[model samples]
Target: MSRFELLVRGGTLVVPYVGTIRADLAVAGGRVAAIGLDIPVSDAATVLDATGKLVFPGAVDAHFHLGIYRPLSVDAAEETRSSLVGGATTVLSYFRTGQHYLNKTGPYETIFPEVLSSVAGHAWTDYGFHLAPMDTAQVREVPSLVEQSGVSSFKYYMFYKGFNLSADSRDAKAFTMSDEYDLGHLYQLMEAVAEAGRSADRRVSLSLHCEQAELMRLFIDRVRADGDPQTLKAYSDARPPLTERVAIGEATTLARATGCAVNLLHLSSGEALAAAREARAAMPGVDMRFEVTLHHLCLSYDELDGLGAKVNPPIRSHADTEALWDGILDGTIGWVASDHACCLEAEKGDELWPALPGFGGTALLYPILLSEGMHKRGLSPTRVAELVSANPARAYGLDGRKGNLLVGYDADLTIVDPDLEQEVTTDLLLSGQDHCPFEGRKVRGWPVATVLRGRIAYQNGQVVGSPTGQFVAR
Candidate 1:
């Protein structure tokens, strides 16, 4: 038998927190075995020449939504294929017992297993889930879910308390399965996370969607009555930054009291970013991390094409976009993610109010960062690696094996050719969803290949190998 399974030779490796170095990486048994110059080709089964390419640890996308808007099996196959093409080898998606996702109200004891079984053999990349307890019964299952299910993170949707997807409804109970998503329930959820952390083998975190429901409802009514319902600005005006700010304050306060680690997801506005900073200062001991989405970083409301850019916590102005970049530069933002939901074009109608929020961008994950952060903004390759790979791995409890380009870690990597430039188009994307909000835009830097567990899964904008992904236990 060969001593090494594969060798990636003559590449510029982007090591997190360390400067880039030219090295040859050896892989055996699906993990990085060695890193040095001129490993003997006789010892490996295959050699891939990576000359003139930038080799980065494959991105760990921490905030993905696969089965939420579509079938889990289909979403896993298609979206993860797109994610791999974009250089993400592993995806940690959020799943909950809700009206849209599993479409049931019950204990996770039955539901989570069904969720796991549904995507058992379908994904093209390694995958895990962060679950939300939508009711009291599900909340009581947190400890077991952590210990047995290998789920170390939980979610709280702050805007689902009494809000509706459309402007006409008054109650969110049918959607969330409970009327208890208020502050008291949030406190209890934090307490449960704290309790789980005491015995969990890894860190446990509570990820929150921090938009205040009552405030959003009021604003939505006013916007519907007074504003143009067809424009992206109207959506932004409806769920303004103050709503996110208030909810951030409330979440961090409860987190400080419960001593639970908290992650603020998809922060989109200047006011929200400022409030997140204040919350961190107020609770210096509480573990808190912030995430920004690709849409927030790349496009603002004034620049959007249509209602397809309408996401929850809607995109803000140019000033807010600048604020997000500042946060990323100053190290206040821990990571950037796609918040990728494969909402179809038909679902996103011309009308803004009824249009479904969220569109897939997993295929643009690394390209956008490479274009804006490295080519345009002067961010170093090291910082870009951390923003996409290392920070998210550390934040979401995947640091043991998923993040860095170190020996004994999974040999998951993406090779990018910085000189390759391409325009964003729907046909170029591998996602099942047909429309891209960023269509026709040009971006520099692109992924040339992706490796998962020493197997080449994507190369030259195509999926090259069979699905070799497994459930990643935290």
Candidate 2:
């Protein structure tokens, strides 16, 4: 009988918070079994020669919206294919009862199961969801949703209260069924999440999209009348840093009062970062985690390719990008993710104000981290592993199975050839979306292969097997 099912030989293994070592990794029954200078491969069912490559734990992209712009089934099949190409073995996508997702408002009892069924057999990588409670009725279902559905993390969009759209837009009720997505509702939601967390076996958290809606509404009117609303610069000006900072402060205060664990999503500017720091200082007991995205870290307003670069809490200036990098290096930022939303070219119009908010970046998750974090910023491979894998896995409650290369951890990994260089082009990407905001940018240290649970899912720029991904419960 074979001692192991698979053996990956002769690679430099990078473990987060641990230094690199050259070892052969062994896998049996879809879990890591051993690692050493030489693991006997004679009886292995499969063997991969990974000579001269950097092998790190497969990235866990903690933020994505697979079905926000496309049908759920279509988006899951295509976008997860793109995620595999970038070496992510696990994805935690955000779903809600809203206009963009399912375009319906109801109790999560029916809605969440539908969300799960839509992508059940289509994903190419293991997946889960972080849900948002949009109304009072939905808020009442949080405990059951967390307990029965195995969903540990919930979300609150701070800017969706009463005024969700622009000043001229009349579709507020279409997005949310509630008349009050206000602070009182947020406080109640936090209390419920905190209560659930107290009893749940795993860590439960609340993720917030921290931008004040009233500020956004007022500024959009000013920008349309006085400033040009069709430029990336104008988008940034309309939703300024102060709005994000103010919301962060308010949300953290409510979190403190309710004893809820908070995960602040996609902090875009220096002011936001500063406010997060202040909140942490003020309320030492509130558990808070901060997140930054690839777009925020890599692309700035100066380098945007047009309407495609526009996103919620829009990408900021070059100085803001530098500040984010500083936070990443100094351990203030908890993790990095691709808020990958596959908005197509047709939806992203020529004018920035009318274009859809998000673009696909899951295909660039690992390469961009290596190109910028390791090559340019002097970040160690271990740090890169934590930023993309370990920390996120812990944050979203997949810590035991997904994050590191350990004796019992899932055999999920990405092998990168540091010498290889590639350019970002729409043709090179696997997303169903036709355009890329990162088009024409050159990056190095690309992922050459990806391993998911002892099987090679992607190698040499191609997906190897059919969709074998499963629903990962929290």
Candidate 3:
């Protein structure tokens, strides 16, 4: 038999398509070399006894925002480490040009290098980027970004037209995407993206942040006018389920008109899923895909009050959460992500009415979901792998390469003690943000050892390897 670099001894390798069984997974040159029982370890360079562990393919987080929430140089590396601990071996973060990233100027030509520089050698696992087109210049640069930056995925923020380019200090209400002229320009950019995608055999998928801007502005006005702080449901009542439904319909219509593939981000309500279903059924060429966050699956609008759960489109009702769970089991929901945007406690506590749109939950995702999703909810372990790893990889074109435990796949794997129990604690987390909404929440199943490219990057509670995470060129 051929010699191997490392051998994972005596674990039941759980490949989704292939049934689970006892096997020894061998690795060399960062790819799976062999799998069978009782491989003699005398010839191997290193060995891991995964005797009682559920060895799973490392997760591929399809949606992540590296530099947007904070600086890439300072925050991206740290955040990537948090992802590593949670078993995400590969992360696809979205970046846009302008002030929020670094207060920079010029097109992507000027902005791309600075973004790359900030994240150099700072991740424990591999990484990729998705660029959001904010202007005509970026729309034109899509093909080059795909070829050079290896970014095949792009984003379209429906509600942040003018606000996207402006700094946070500026009055966002004054420069919203609802400005009629800018909305038209945004559609033009979308059309350009559609055309660009045609040439690249792999259709460049556009991720849409679907929220109707005008309706949101109107609802916020009515809510503040009513001025009831205790009505935690007010946030959801304001950005009602209909709002997401409307935007989803608009996104699919645009996709059909332009011949582009659309992927809706962080959909929280039942109405939104219904719209996506309608689009797929109606539009012949429109490849419409949508996803819901793990937080949405596990939490609801009533559990933590409005602000704590005040994510965009909101946490929604119990009915909506149940619908999301159903979608996960049925496979209509493409993937499950963290949608983790960590805002400081002080920052998140700015106002009672409308502080900001998000909160941090990166470290809490896996344990919370595994505990609640599998243990409490009775979802099969097979379903967990599909939602967390396999489906996300396939959706983003990183399938066999990153999501599955197959020969020729990257040696990115997670070792989880399936029966381990733990409570969510901010102190133990590796995130740059200090607090999480899920603190004190208990969950079963935890990843103890995370391997990235055959290197032990995160084990127990500490990062073991250098942040030499390569820029994965898709």
Candidate 4:
């Protein structure tokens, strides 16, 4: 008799490299113990019948911002609930300390403890944080953060040189500011991070928000001077594809200069992808990774006529959408993130030009991808797993434990009814924010259930666990 804690039978288990196979999975001590047919299941504590279902590795959303500028308690609790419904089991998010979150300038020792306490006993999924080194002290303390809190990843917003994008100041609603670059400050920050990454035994890594700050300023100012709906054209025109092209070129150059592995966040245009590809090809030794969102994959400028469609790196033309799909098809693009920074509709301005940039997509993540990328585009299911699961896990060093359904990996899994199709509506959303840009869009794939570490965390639209989501170190 096998000592099994749980047995999941009748579903085809999809492992990353081996392809999909119908197998009975037995779990013990929170790891897959055996996978075969008719493994005697009477000793198991529980059994799950996965008839007519696809069992794929649960998504690891690498670029999420929960509790960013908001109070930690409210943000962490609500976002974890939102993540469970969307079938994401592991969330890797960035916490900034300058002025955006916590409102204090301090070291990781001060900030991390506060962060840990706020999120403790409140999350329904496993969590990890990437600290943004806002000051010189935080930069030097990167290795110590890794040693103390097990947080092995760090981020820098090359675009937000000084101030950051926050909610409203007086009204407490719509606040968007850009990061500035003080030459001495940014260079030292990058240098310190590279040194710390080299020394840390757990392999600390770095990520960058690559848009050029000065260019963005110039472009935004140019749009204002021109004025009106025509300014909309100027907005996309000034910060055109070339802006991303130039910025990506510079980022790759900086990564090579710093001798650090770099992950580029939110590469929306084809030009950006090509630039990353070109940089990697030119310098074979440089470690670089890039990702784009589901919104960029499906929606175009025409679809975004209202302020709701507005976002940074504004949704491009139809041709750009096609090109992004091309990148997804060819494997140049790495992972897919919701970038699920949501804002209320009231916060969005009446005009197209001044509206707040982002809208909610946490609830629509899987459905949007399934509708546009998999069902409509004819992308392989295996490829969907790679984009949503495998690559993100590998990039963030969570691969061994999070992104696969193999023996010894976490039992985090998503069961989807690929044939169950429905139109997306904001009324069904569970995020703290109430609006979505993809409202009214229909998709064919829906998550039937989400399991985190051998426990049913979400089923049929509600959370099941005790909010025992563990905070992952590195």
Candidate 5:
């Protein structure tokens, strides 16, 4: 028997907050056992020769929707399989008691367990959930959710207050199926999370989807009334950056008031990023972190051709994309995520108004950052590692166990061929979704292998085995 179960030899390890270094990584019992020079290849049972590749921590894709459109078990199987291609070993997906997911409303005591049961055996990556407390009853569950269920994070959709954008209806109840999911409910949720944080040693935080509902109602009405263009630009106009700014103010004000740590999720526009920065400056004492998504950083309504690129807090102009990249380069943005919701083409049809928002980009996580961010924008490999991996792990309470390629951490890493370039296609991503929003674009820095818990989950552009992914406590 060998001392190490697996060894990745001759690679440059990109460690977040610490720069890159040449090292041989050894794994034992699913945790990183050693990282140093001259670990003989014969000592390991399995060895992967990574002579010239860059090895990075497997990304913790913080924003995901495992079952938003499809059934829980199915998304668990297919979406997570897609995650492997992206070099994400762990995924923290969002769940809510609403119309699309499970299509029913109930206390998480029952619903959460059922959700867990449905996805338990189907996933191909370690997973956790960031639940939305849609009603007061669910808000009451926050304490137990944090302590017992190991759910350190919660969510509140700022735009789901009084409107249902999905159905183009004013009644949010038509979609949320909850009781008055407005600012008041958000306050209670924050209060619960804040209070819960007092007891837990780890962070107990709330994530807000910051798009104001009333503003959306007004703009949507105006857009529809003024000869709706039926383009991505029209979608962007309907739900402009103004909504994000106002919602940031509303959410951050409450975050400051309740003393709750908050994450401003998927800030889509330059205006939105500016508002978040202003809020951070004003409330220096509050713990607020900002996030940008891959689509927001690269794709814009002007550049993207079809409705497949349509997403909530709609993809902005090229200026907004550059602004977000500025945020990333300047340290204003801590992390980037895919905001991956596996919506198929049939769901996203020809009509922009009724088409579902969001498409899968998880598989392009490393590829895009490496291609555009590093290769074009001069983003350092170390910062790229932090943006995709470490920062997200710290934000959502998976830091010590999952983020770095250090001794005693989970041996979750990806070996990348930094020079390998390939065009984006639905077939390449291995997702269940039939069409890809980012097709035809060329990307470099492809991951040759992705290891989850010291086991090779994906290698040589193929998934390695059956679903061995386990549920992460936090």
Candidate 6:
């Protein structure tokens, strides 16, 4: 019998917060057992020759929407398969009792179990849920969810406060399906989260989608009254940076009052980044971390005219995109994520107003960061790994097991060819979504093989085996 189950030989390992090191890694029983030079190839049952590649820790895609637009089982099957293409081994998806997901309001005890059952056998990546407490009843379930169910993170959509986006629906309540989803609800939710954090060993935090809805209503009315050009620019105008700025103020103020740890999700504009900095200065007592998505750092309204590019805190100008890059480099941003939601083309039709916001990008998570951030912008491989892998894992409670190429961690990683180049295409992504907003952009650095739990799950652009993904408890 072989000493090691699998061996990956001669690759540069991107260790988060640590410099890249040239080494060979051995895996036994789905865990990294050793990392050194020149272990005998005959000692391993299976060996992958990775002489010229870079080995990165499989990304923990922190923000994802599984089954948001499709059936849960179908999404769990296809979307997580797509995740393997990008070297993502785990997905922490957000679930709430809302209009799009399951389309009902109920207890997390019943609803969360159902969500789990639906995704159980269908998944291709290890997964967990950040369940949102939309109503007061659910708010009381926070401690139980954190302690028993191993769900420590929650989300609040500040944009759903008073502003309604639907053409047919009259009120925001129709979308949220909750009782009073205002600052009052958020306040109570924060207090509950803070108390839960104090009692639990894991970190309990609230992630806010920081775009002020009342200001959105005002700007939306103004945009409609004027020419109201049907473009991405118009969409950006309708939901400007001021909304995000104000929302940050409100959210942080409440976080300070409640002593709740908060994460500001998808800061889209330069002004929004500035506002987050200001909040950090003012509320020094409150714990706050900032997240920037792939699209916010790369895509811009000024360049991408497609309506499918429309997203919450709508894509800002190219200047704003550069500003976000500055935040990433200067250390203001805690982590980068895909915020990957697989919205199909039919869902994001020609109309900008009624169009769905997100598109699939999990397949491009590591690729784009390596191409645009490392190759183009001179971000170190270690820093790139930190943004996509280690930092998010530490923040979202998947820290020790999933983040880096550390001994005793899960043997989840990808072997990347540093010079591999390809144009972006929906087919290349292997997602259920039929269209890609980043369709034509050329990218360098692609994963030649992705290994999940000591097994090659994806190689040469195809999923290699059956679904062996287990649900992550935390």
| Runs in model 1 lying further than 4 Å from the true structure | 164-167, 170-177
Q: Candidate 2, residues 1-474: lDDT per residue as tens digits?
A: 788888889999998878798998999889999988788779588888889999989999999997997899999999998998788999999998767888888888998889999999999899999999877888898899888998999999887775744444622232343677799889999999999999988889999999887787788778878856578888888889989998998999999999999999999998899999889888999999999999999889887758888888898999999999999989899999999999898887787666778888998888988999999999899999999999999988898899899889999998898778999998676889899988999999889989899899999888887988888999
User: Which candidate leads in lDDT?
Assistant: 5
Supply candidate 5's per-residue lDDT for 254.
97
Give the per-residue Cα lDDT of candidate 2 at 427. Answer: 69
> What would the per-residue lDDT of candidate 6 be over residues 92-180, giving only the tens digit for each residue?
89998878878877899999989999999988888999988988999999999998898989999897886444543322222453548
lDDT per residue as tens, model 5, 1-474: 999999999999999999999999999999999998979998999999899999999999999999999999999899989889989999999999867889888899999999999999899899999999888888899999998897999998888777644655532232453557888889988999999999888888999999987888899889988898878898899889999999999999999999999999999999999999999999999999999999998898778869888788798999999999999999999899999999989987787777888899999999999999999999999999999999999999898998888899999999999999999999999899999878999998899999999999999889998988898998
Candidate 4: where is the Cα deviation over 4 Å? Answer: 162-180, 201-203, 230-235, 351-354
lDDT of 6 at 83: 93
TM-score of each: 0.97, 0.97, 0.92, 0.91, 0.98, 0.97
Task: Tell me the lDDT of candidate 6.
Answer: 0.89
Task: Count backbone clashes in candidate 4.
Answer: 7
lDDT of 4 by residue, 1-474 (tens): 448877888887777766888888888877777888876668687887777877878888887777754677776777777777667888887787755557666677877888889888887778899888766666778767767778777887665543344532211222333333444555666666667778765455677766665676676666656653443345476567777877777777777787777788778777877887899899777778888877777777756655666666767777778888888888888888877665667766676554666655665556666667888998777778888888888877786788888889988888877778877776666677767777777788887788888888788877775787888876
lDDT of each: 0.87, 0.88, 0.74, 0.73, 0.91, 0.89
Q: Return model 4's CA RMSD, one decimal.
A: 3.2
lDDT tens digits, residue span 288-350, model 3: 787888778777766766355557767778888888887776778888888766666665563
lDDT of 5 at 129: 96
Error of 5 at 138 (Å): 0.6
**RMSD (Cα, Å) of model 5:** 1.6
Error of 1 at 91 (Å): 0.5
